[model samples]
Target: MPGATSPLPDLSRPDVGAALFSTWSVGTPERQRATVDALAASWNGRSWPTPELLSQNVYVGTDGDTLMHHSQWTSEEAYLTFVRAHRQARVDEIDAAVPGIERNGIANYRRYRGFDTRTEGDPRVPGCIVAIKADFDDPDPDLRRKWIDLVIEALETDPAPSPGLISADFHLIVSGARHLANNRVEVLNYAQWTSEEAYDAAIAADDPTPEWERVRHFPGFKGTTAKRYRFERSFVRP
Candidate 1:
């Protein structure tokens, strides 16, 4: 087990039941890039699974020129350190890097726990969603406002028929990071689904509507893509 490492720090097995799904808006391309680099560098110092299997992607929404920068981390402690270490000062720095960018939208954050299966027992796959991060972008502030309103409508009005999604949380990358780097990264959305199937199906719905495309795939966003793999969780951590 030369390169082998636990998905969860200090935990014997993967905690399949829990996970983290988060979305963020990092202002602009330059700001988002800075945030991404800062995050990678920060996580490099933390102990966790190999980075090779990790996934990251960026998407741009047409609704208001919003961009979503997404990443799936492999460690909970690494994620925690990321949050606690980077706050308001980080926020200020991202703003300083971009200059005069004001967003009226609030970011979301969540930590999902309790699984139907145990990651410790399963050899196929281990651990829950270590972390999910996304960022939004818009060319016009007014459009951003309108887009937010539309997003709220979709989240509430057009709820999924059989949503596998569970609890969701919210947060904004504030400022003044003594532990982590200085960069503003907002936590826009987070949720826990019952299973990977439910998660995939929830997102798999194909709607011809333009709005639907905006949610699934936006144009302004940019980043490395994701290559999926299938796994089953048989282990549990107590």
Candidate 2:
């Protein structure tokens, strides 16, 4: 993993209670990553809450407008504290450094399962990731758990039956959005594949059991959306 980012926080720690995912944007991938790199360096260990776990400065691809910053914190309060401080001042520095870049979205999620804290290097997905965020009414706890399991199976097995997957992470919303706000995605599913082309081919394969059919029309299924992210900068705790 040459050019790999370093000093990433470990996600496996029990103390790492929450994750903050913020998406920002710049006109080009080069500027998007460069600006965020500068912003991250500016706050490098200088802010509150400290983001003690890992942070992904993911902006390596040249297609999309949104670049994501992923960080893990010791607790929800610590996350909020960092958010407060970031909103108060650090954003100005970002704006000054990258005049056109803007924050596209922000989410604070309770890490539910499969964050893969065991690994000691940058995340190994060679191509890109498919991130799904969804909202649903909790009608049955048992059934919900079952659905989660089944979906995880899809991600792990990759309904496409390919070995291109590096990893997958799933989570449920703690309190990120509201139903009325129209952005209330309560559950999340993430999958990594060799390339965007591979993902597209898999989705088009007409296979129903592993990924699409098992979850999309699930018993308690409600609504969801997807975003694509290129493998960017990732870190591991020393």
Candidate 3:
């Protein structure tokens, strides 16, 4: 079967890299945006050792916390190296900037080997796809439609839409036991590409479009929360 982002890596090579997942909640909407901005800035200058898969969810419930984020890393050693080198410093910056963030929900990091998920191995320089899911609100129908158009325009504004992008199927995730399946929800991104370089280039394009500006200010944006998962195992088709 085909791999998630890119083609599976050759097992004959060295140790298959690791996949790290972290899940946490940011207290408020303002803090959520700030955290994402800060983390994005930190990722800018560093020579990222491995590719990453990123996804975010903002639940409407008020049980524990409403915001969460999910990010996948390339390898365990590489993730550990990055954490030892930058995690503490980044967290301090996050706390200082966004007072609402409490703590990383999962402290003990987890890793999943590549072999469990693919026939050969997971890709080394995988293309990344980022999706943000949100349940319907009073004003979400019109706003969600607008956001979808804006997103497509933003993507089209990029000149080279290939390379990392083998294909991008924007799924609605109609019915599932997933977070966004509650109501008139929307899953705004579904993409696949060849390499991380290609994906980055497509996103970091020279476009002055104000498409994303309006959505960023939308009321549905509670915060950019995430979760990290290790592939302990996966069921594949034969």
lDDT of 1 at 83: 53
Per-residue lDDT tens digits for candidate 2, residues 61-142, read 3354677666666666665666566655666777777787766666666545663322577554446767777667764445
The lDDT for every candidate, in the order shown, is 0.37, 0.59, 0.40
Give lDDT tens digits, candidate 3, residues 15-96.
3232222344676545555665665444443444334312111211122333333333334445556667767875776667
Model 1 lDDT vs. the true structure? 0.37
Worst 10 residues of 3 by lDDT: 108-117
- How close is every model to the real structure, measured as TM-score? 0.32, 0.73, 0.32
* Sort order, lDDT high to low: 2, 3, 1
For residues 5-26, write the lDDT of model 1, one tens digit per residue: 2232221123311122233455
Model 1: CA > 4 A from native:
1-131, 137-150, 176-179, 182-184, 208-238
Candidate 2, after superposition: displacement of residue 95 in Å?
Answer: 0.6
Best-fitting candidate, scored by TM-score:
2
Residue 41 deviation, candidate 2, in Å? 3.9
Pitting candidate 2 against candidate 3, the one with the higher TM-score is: 2
Q: Select the stronger candidate by TM-score from 1 and 2.
A: 2
lDDT (Cα, 0-100) at 40 in candidate 1: 40
